[model samples]
Each structure stands twice: as C-alpha cells, then as structure tokens.
Target: MTSDLRLSRFEYGFAQFMSVMASAPAKLEEKPKERTHQTRDRSREPHSRSMPFRNEMGSEMVDIYVGPEEEPFRVHKQKLCRRIPYFDKMFNGQFKEASENVGRLPEDDPAAFDVLME
Candidate 1:
C-alpha cells in the first residue's frame, strides 16, 4: 500500500514541478480594473438612514439583563445578530425581544455575558 502511494506521488516528479514554478511570474503586474457599477454617494444621505447593519457602520444598541440581579449590558444589535445565532433569531424573528429591543437571561451569569461582549 505504501509503495503504491509512493508511486502515485512520484508520477509528477520534483524536477518537473520546480521547472513549472520557475517559469511562472513571481507576482501579477495587472492594474486593478475599475468598478463597472455606479456606486451611490453615501455622503449625501443621512447617517441614520444609511445601511445601519453593515460592518463598516454602527447599528442600534440593545439592552440585555443577565443573572439573578438582572445586571444590564448594552451591546450593538448588529454585532450580536451577526456573531450569535440565538441573538440573530431573537432580534430578527417575530419575538417580544425584537419589538422591545431588550433581552433577559435571569439565569445566565453576568460575568459570562461580559466575557462574550469582549
């Protein structure tokens, strides 16, 4: 089995591989092609009206109360939705949390939530 594997591996010899690599360009020298689509000037639009959920822009914040004491933690809704599946469902779905923009986890540890935020 080992001999068969070795025979297959040697089918393309090291010399042939090296020769091909040597003939190839070290780096591509082509200039970047211009974008074909006309991008809308975002500067003219209001910041709040812009794409809020995009990674480059900051989204609305949400308040999540955790632990027995109900320690409140403020986090970006977009970040939470993008990173955590539970948050994504809760925020986007037809749930009370989506409407209120607040979440409660009375049993979950506040420290764990803090770590998650970090």
Candidate 2:
C-alpha cells in the first residue's frame, strides 16, 4: 500500500511537470502574437521624405558644389558644418566661402564626397 501511494505521487508530479512544459510553448507563441501586433502598428506610421544624406527639394540654405564640371555634389552647409570641423571653420570663419552662399571643392573627388555625404 505504501509503495502504491509513492508511485501515484510520483506519477502526479511527473504529469504536472509535463503540463508546465507543454504550456511554456503556448506562452511563447502568445508573446510573438503581441509583438506582431506592435510591428504592424509601427509599419502603419508615415516615413520621412528626406534620407540620412540626400535631400531633393534644393531647399537647404547653402550649397557645396564638389569636383569639376563633369561631376558635382549638392550638399547642405549646415549638414557639412555639423559633421566636419574643417567645414565649420571655413563656413564660420572670415573666409570667401562664408561670404558667398556657394562653396566649391575643386580638388576633392566627387565619388569620395558622395560616400562622405552618405
């Protein structure tokens, strides 16, 4: 009788453990459902027209025309000044670039400028 009681207890405990293990996967599945709902909501949000480097409207205050006549990059002064110390000095200092609305980088490669801009 004592042996039967111990075996029954062990069986009950084993059944409970198995049930918990089975429910764990169900709980994991529920979590992904909630995440999918959140992802769908985020996807519905509007995206900005301007990218990290490119702005197409030509509305930026200043322009930097890089390279020779063959290739050029129209870059924003504020963006350049914010990123590079050399550009900040040239634009903020008492230089011709500061006076004029436009600046030129005749020697610099246009391809290199495109990479920097991106």
lDDT top scorer = 1
Model 1: worst 10 consecutive residues (lDDT sum): 20-29
In model 1, the runs with Cα more than 4 Å from the true position are 1-57
The lDDT for every candidate, in the order shown, is 0.67, 0.57
Relative to the true structure, candidate 2 has a C-alpha RMSD (angstroms) of 26.5
Give per-residue CA lDDT, model 2, range 1-118, as digits (tens): 3454444433554454334434554454443334343433446555663454355323456667766763645667777666655666667778887887667776555555555565
Judged by TM-score, which candidate is best?
1
Per-model RMSD to reference: 18.3, 26.5
State the displacement of the C-alpha of residue 87, model 1, in Å, after optimal TM-score superposition: 0.5
* lDDT agreement of model 1 with the native: 0.67
User: Clashing residue pairs in candidate 1, if any?
Assistant: none
Candidate 2 residue pairs that clash:
none
